[model samples]
Target chain A: MPILEVKNLNVSFKTIDGVVQAVNNVSFNVEHGEVLGIVGESGSGKSQSVLAIMGLLASNATVTGSIKFLGQELVGVNTKALNKVRGNKLSIIFQDPMTSLNPYLTIKSQMTEVLMLHKGMSKHDAVIESIRMLDFVGIPEAKERIGLYPHEFSGGMRQRVMIAMALLCRPELLIADEPTTALDVTVQAQILKILRDLQTEFKMSIILITHDMGVVANACDRVNVMYAGQLMESGSLDNIFYEPQHPYTQALLASIPSLEHEVERLATIPGEPPNLLALPDGCVFQGRCHKVHQECKGGDVVVQDFGAGRFMKCNLMQNLTNGINQGITSNVVVN
Target chain B: MEKLLEIKDLKVYFELKRSLLGKKRIVYAVDNVSFDVYKGETLGIVGESGCGKSTLARSLVGLNDITDGNVVFLGKDNLAKADSKRWHALRQEIQFIFQDPVASLNPRMTVAEIIAEPLNVYYPKMKDEEVLAKVLDMMHLVGLSDNQINRYPQEFSGGQCQRIGIARALVLNPKLIICDESVSALDVSIKAQIINLLKDLQKKLSLTVIFISHDLSVVKHICDRVLVMYLGNIMELATKEVIYKNHHHPYTQALLAAVPSANPKVEKHKHVKPLEGELPSPLHPPQGCVFSTRCPLADDGCKSARPELRYMDDGALVACFKA
Candidate 1:
């Protein structure tokens, strides 16, 4: 079974203005020991979907549908029961290490608290374990630095501490949200390398949420392209990078500047993302999609299933693929 | 290409006043950096955090005091020697666009007022109608609608706020504009839009821009030439092609290699050796080269003597003995 399976997940927030549908009916699966990347622009609801799984939404927000981990339904579960799985079996590393870590607490207390709470480890044993984890994440003199406060460490070092804290229990699944966004390129590279190595050592599945295509390409085994809270495309990293079917995915890939080649002008999807409170009746990306067609204006756009664990939500791609599939079947019959 | 600006041995140091018992210290933020920016070209300055790229940009606009060296503009005006009144006048010809779009803009002010503020300060005697026309024209150039001019920055998204920022920068029709990580805070799609708009405006107005960013790919896309800095020192200065393809300095190579490739196939085949160790504190930088501690090719010679920037066979300037 997959490590995580999210089906038709929707998250909405009630504000003074109206209801803001942050995450649409998003569905995907993370296989065991595989890295799943969720790529999207801001307001695309990539972060919200993961937060929904962790049961960390705001008080005014509402969530529906199923989020199953190891064949167990997580939605609507009591907080006490959910807490047992959270921070132990399933862990998350936040975007900004500076703000996520408590300013008043030292690294030793913050890290040991997790082990003591989850594993019932003694303070002495927890300290030893915390130091070992920190050393594993490449913090120099981990033993001596364990007593330092978060402010004492640099940006990269703080991020490493966050990673070590997240893996304190050796979680089966890890969720890292823009782990390298605030870091410099060289430091980001080092962090990514550590994550890659840790995944191998612990055999843990990871859900990496980011806006950078470069990071997705480098780290993720599979990719899901999100646009305006909807899943535009879901497939292997190679499938998404080399053969993106959805217009939103294609436009996103074309928009990013490549390190290997220089284009005369980057292709941009004109117009801002749709306002959540007043989204269009048709496709979520219809306003900015270059290949938007009349069918897309119709109310419903079904997810098209291409076999071999690939899917896309676009009316235009569905028609094209249907034609190709029919041609392939007819050719097989003739043979 | 004509030389638009010349920076000679620029230095910006911040003194740390310790307690009476402790010795005083100085943070060498921008130490002995010299370069020339050509007219009608986008010069990109790239480095890690605390590498003084922002300090270098702020120094050009008089936002930071120059501890030493000279800033010669247009080969005639010695900006380093300019008084307050002269500096105030020079501000009309040199504008700046800040990094954070939302934070940089005043939330209380409307888009029209924000863009018109520059004109109001520089030409107070001009008619209100003339100011409104210029603001409208600048808004149109930066892709903002005229109807939204009355809306506050809080009503707009990050991308639109950036457009407002660009409009304000262009309202004065400055010869040179300094963008300190202007597009770094934006999303990828929005970043592309801003880049395309900047490139278009650069061509239409023949504007010279100094763009400072940590993203190397974005720098390659928009910049004509790139300057690589490390710990307030210029490690490499060359055209985009040379900097990206034929870089000599070990720091430049490490910086390039650290950028994750957007293409999976290419990334799979590429071998990346990320630079090790964090940037040394500026208060007590290495006695020799600024990057010697983290440089992979560092040896006794590199650790003992500082390398001076010199011209290479390909016309690129490198500051490493091995290079």
Candidate 2:
């Protein structure tokens, strides 16, 4: 069985005005020890979908879905049982380090709290284990800095501290939300190296949420494209990069000013994302899509299996057009 | 090309009380940094956090008063006293686009109100109908619709909100616009959209833009000339071709390395070797070369003596001992 299976996940946020459908019938899976990347623009709801699966959605958000984690339904799991699965089985590393970390508490206090709560370790053992976790994420002289507050460390180092705190319970699955967004490139490389190495050693599945194609290409095995809270496309990394089926995904790839790309002008997706509250009758990408058709108004994800477990979703009437674009633009766009 | 804006050894300092006896503590935010913005060109000022990119920007725009040296805008020097009329004129000509859209724009105000605020202040005598018409034209230019005009800042997404910010800056038709990490807060796809919009606006308006950002890739995408700063000093300034292709300063190269390659072949490969240590605090900077503490190429000479930015070309300038 897959490590985690999310089936037809539908999520909505209850604001004062009305229910905003954030995630609409999205489904994906992560195999054991696999790194799945969910890439999209801002307000894509990639973060919300995964947060729903982890049973960590915000207080007002209403979720309707079947999330199976190691064969257990996570949607309706009790708070007590969910708490057991949260820190030990599944964990999250949020984007902003400054807000995520407590300014007054030391790394030792934070890491040890998770250890004692989830792993049920003694104070003495927790201290030792916390230092080990710190060292693993590359906080140099973990013994000395463990007592330092979040404000004492640099931004990159503080993120490492956050990672150390998350991994204290030896989670089976890690949900890293824009883990490298605020970091510089070299520091990003260091973080990715650390996460990849630790994932192999611990044999944990990972779902990285980011809007950066570079990050997705570097880290993930599978890529899921989300837009306006809908899964526009899902496929292997090779399929997503080499032959993007969806118009939105193709436009996203075109917009990146890459080293491989030689162009007079980049093609930006023409319009803004549809507001989650006022979605159109057609596909979510229809407004910005170049090859949008009447068939796309039906909201059917035309999926084609390219064998070997790879899948693609495109407009049924416009597959050949995107294919021709793939061949023509691929040469100029890819190095 | 005639330089539109020139900074001659600009130094901005803040003095604070340190002890009971009122000892002074000086924060050298922009220490002897100098550069020029030319006609219809984009100059990128890049540095990591606390390296004083925004400080230099504030100093140039006359928001933060300068402590030393002159910032020559057009033909006049503003370091000394300039009349209120000239100050107001400078305000109209030189504009700033802030980093965070959510923070920069007023949440309570609609997009039309936010964009019109500056126009009302700067063009007090202008007709109200004309201003609203121009606002709609600008909205169309930045890819926003007329329906979004009445919507509040919170109603739009980050990208849409930033478009409103850009439209506000462009409503005045300024010659020089200071974008201080404008795209840094956006996603890559959205970043490209904003960048493309800015580029389009720049060309159409013949804008002389000073784009400040730490990301080299973003600078590479938009700028004509790039100035690499470290610890409040100009380490290097060259054309994008020369800087990205063959950067001379160790700090500039190191900064370039820190931007993760969008390509697959090269991961986070250090360009000039790993910068040895963190950036020294601006409050108490190191002696001589500011980057010596974190420079792999530092020598004994680097620790003891400072290097001035000598002209490599008439255009390119580098301030490294080894360079």
RMSD of each: 4.0, 3.4
* lDDT per residue as tens, model 2, A1-335: 89899998999999988789999888888899999999887778999998898788899988887999999899977899999899788999999999998888888888898889888899999999999999999888999999999999987898899888888888889999999888866577678877878888899999999988878777788899998888887877767786776677777887887643345466676667887888887677777667768887765657665555555565543333323433334322221
* Residue B1, candidate 2: C-alpha displacement in angstroms: 0.7
Task: Write candidate 1's Cα lDDT for B1-323 as tens digits.
Answer: 89999999999999998858898889999999999999999999999999999999998988888899999999988777888898898888899999999999999999999999999999999999999999999999999888998999999999899999999999999999999999998988888899999989999999999999999999999999999999999999999999999999999999989889999887787777778899999999998988999998899999999999999999999999999
Best by TM-score: 1
Q: Tens digit of lDDT per residue, candidate 2, span B1-323?
A: 98888788789888877968787788888898777889899999988778888989987777777888878888675643555677777777888898998889989998989889888997788898998998999899888989888999887778888899898888888888999999888876677778888888899889999999877767787889999888789899999888888889988777666555544445423233334336677888988899998788888999999999988854579998898
Chain A superposition TM-score, candidate 2: 0.92
All candidates: TM-score of chain A: 0.95, 0.92
Cα deviation of B89 in candidate 2 (Å)? Answer: 2.7
Query: Once superposed on the true structure, which residue ranges of model 1 sit more than 4 Å away at CA?
Result: A319-335
Highest DockQ against the true fold, candidate: 1
